[model samples]
Target: MKDTAKHQGLRNQLVKLLAEKGIYDTNVLNAMNAVPRHLFLESGFQDFAYQDTAFPIGAGQTISQPYTVAFQSQLLQVKADDKVLEIGTGSGYQTAVLCKMGAKVFTIERQNELYRKTSVLLPKLGYRPRVVSFGDGYKGLPNDAPFDSIIVTAGAPFVPQPLLAQLKIGGRLVIPVGDEKQVMTLLIRTSETHFEQHEFGDFKFVPMLEDKNR
Candidate 1:
């Protein structure tokens, strides 16, 4: 019961942080609360899980900040049982949030070490999303095409055409875009040939690399 108590405390802290930061969506808050942020961090960093900062998980990658995760998830507007594509699995923290929000997530990781680690950790945490190989996240998951939503955790120079093509009409893609500095962007598929894009202010993220696996 000690673990359960700790989880509850973390959840309360996350809710308080979200409210303080103006994350008003109940769904996003609940998902943030449901997922155990501590599980995604190194053992030594468990105490810092409730803080609003990115923490390293090796392989030069960091688990994204809670606000970033909540903002992306909220922008995607994921519905229960929706199929969502995640570009970078990282430490699987965002993946866990997606799963908790009721998204059927298909995630890809470019770093082999991080991929292997998250693959083992996720199932152990009871929040496994479908894991795929490393490559250009811009390509997205085609076999699972026409997804309900797509989220890219890394910052890209531009929205990849292939990902836009994979979005079902009315589906949304939430990603960070720009070079060096980035801004969170939300793209909505209006029709087979049209899209609407919105910029959601500045954010920093690791550059989205191509073919890190090769």
Candidate 2:
């Protein structure tokens, strides 16, 4: 489906809702407004795309609730030209948001189905990440380490050490860490060997699994 004027209106409404829900980052809100979230969903679900809730995008993964996406993105504090590594590309919706905010995005997806679909869809929508590979999220992207920030869209039982290792000094890694219900956790690499940790309430996400689809 195409991004119509109606879609734009819906997005504006969504952004307004996000702001009301405490997303004060103008960059994040503007990116959220600019990216056509409805386009990332299937045709059948497109109607509900502007809703704040999540919808299944096949492969047992959901396209992340709009609020969750906005919340994580706001926490990231992305700046233009920021090198952001995104774990779990999923629908590529979050990737598009970062891209819209002028970030150089390197994203990983573990599910083959999502990897292929998002790879094609994102570029078609003009949101081309620097690297979009099918891989293990836990490992992050070592070759391109020291990113300005990183975002994990899935729920992890614990923070992946490799992700922490990959952050630049003073860089942020925003992840949802827990079992059934996750606590939104942020780790800022303060120095060569130290990180400051903080938690921002709870959320639910599909598990960040091991390895890629075989």
Candidate 3:
């Protein structure tokens, strides 16, 4: 009961922070609150779980800040039962949020260590993404094509063509594109041959590297 109360307190604090920052989407807020962020971090890092900064999660990857996760998830405009694809599954925090939002997620992680750890943790968190592979996130899951929404956590120089090909018509793809310094971008697939792009704002992220499977 004490752990539950602690998690609830953290959730309330996060909701308050997000609201003050103008993240007014109720769905996003609910999803963020539902997932226990502290469980996704190292036990010692529990105190910082409610804070709005990224933290190390081994293999040079960091669990993205809470606001950033909410921002990207909101930009995707995910809907209930929507088939979603997540490019990076670091810590599985974002994946858990997406799952709690009622999306059927297929997440891929390139790092073997992160993938292994998250695979075990996700089931314990009560939300298991359909597929968590130690493969190239850049290539995406070809077998699971035509996703309603796709989210890329790492920064890429340009939107990968393969991911574009995997989106269903009218689907949205939210990603960060650039080198060390990046900008969050949203791409809407208007038709079989047309896509509309929107730039969100300047941000920084780890560079998206091609996994060995590529």
Give the lDDT ranking, best first: 2, 3, 1
Strongest candidate by TM-score: 2
lDDT of 2 by residue, 19-83 (tens): 99999999999999899998999889989999999999999999999999999999999999999
Candidate 1: the clashing residue pairs are: none
Error of 3 at 140 (Å): 0.3
Backbone clash pairs for candidate 2 read none
lDDT of each: 0.86, 0.94, 0.90
lDDT by residue (tens digit), candidate 3, 98-117? 99898999999988889999
- Stretches > 4 Å off in candidate 2: none
Give per-residue CA lDDT, model 1, range 39-118, as digits (tens): 88889888888888899898888899899898888888888899999999999989988998888989988888888888
Question: In model 1, how large is the Cα lDDT of residue 160?
Answer: 91
User: What ranking of all candidate models by TM-score puts the best one first?
Assistant: 2, 3, 1
For every model in order, what is the number of clashing pairs? 0, 0, 0
Q: How close is candidate 1 to the true structure, as a TM-score?
A: 0.95
**Lowest-lDDT window of 10 residues in candidate 2?**
205-214
How well does candidate 2 match the true structure in TM-score terms? 0.98
